[model samples]
Target: MNNIITIRFSALLILLVAALVTACKKGDNNALTPDLGTRVAGKYTYSELKTGGKTYPASDTNLKGTITLTRQTPTTVAIQLAIVHKATNEAFADDAAEDVDVVEAASGTIELHYNGDTIAKINGSKISIEGEDDAGTVFTLFATK
Candidate 1:
């Protein structure tokens, strides 16, 4: 009985060590390349978010806001932005992104997604935000940092 218990303990220890070793991995010497840098979160000058190769609305061109993106985990990020509503004349800021998946684009473009749809993409110093409003209007914000 003592020998059987000792053998089981030894096997468990070896298995735990093996699993830990496999979980922790390292890339080459130059794993992190500064060429694809993170976009600085701050007040961004507004531009436009276009789909189907065309602008959505003419009135949304003059919007302004402050956006900040923070990393929550290795693969998850949080985005917060506050913008002034032109029609309502009120500041609308939303930090509703709970656990968004972030992936690095091949050409230094970072794409953000929730569920399965791509919500936004950060390309170089440009940030584009798009979402469907309650009224079914596609709200789009294209800004460059």
Candidate 2:
């Protein structure tokens, strides 16, 4: 009778252990969905190409003012660039809004695309964008949070 009771208790213990193991197993769906806008949305100090191997800050008289990024959608964002007069400290162009699609790659890199062309790639807190303006001149923008 004691042997029978011990056998039954061991079987129940084994079943409980198996159940707990199965319940504690991690699932493949534990990966988090990337939110690009929440990660990259902020005001950044903007810099761009000025001339041959030269760069200028956005506050420069020839360049625009600060660049602002706001989230429009899960995959899209709006850019607002301010153009100001340095001496007068007046904003001549307060709003130049442009929309671009943002993609978060599986490798944890963020890409900003305009008109189906990749304009920027962001890694960590640094962002670099390269594209051409309407005047057919190539420009590269670097920004940091």
**Model number with the top lDDT:** 2
Model 2 weakest lDDT span, ten residues long? 58-67
Candidate 2: which pairs clash? none
Top of the candidates by TM-score: 2
What is candidate 1's TM-score against the reference?
0.55
Q: Write the per-residue lDDT of candidate 1 for residues 37-139, one digit (tens) a residue.
A: 2333344545565655577442545455656666666677677766666666475446557577877767777888788878778876777887665666666
Global lDDT of each candidate: 0.66, 0.70
CA error at residue 86 for candidate 2, angstroms: 4.5
TM-score of each: 0.55, 0.60
lDDT of 2: 0.70
- Clash count of each predicted structure: 0, 0
In the range 1-145, model 2's lDDT, one tens digit per residue, is 9999999999999999999998995766625654677667888665554445677766553544566678877678887656456677676445544678888878888987878887678888867766556577776666677
* C-alpha lDDT of residue 134 in model 2: 57
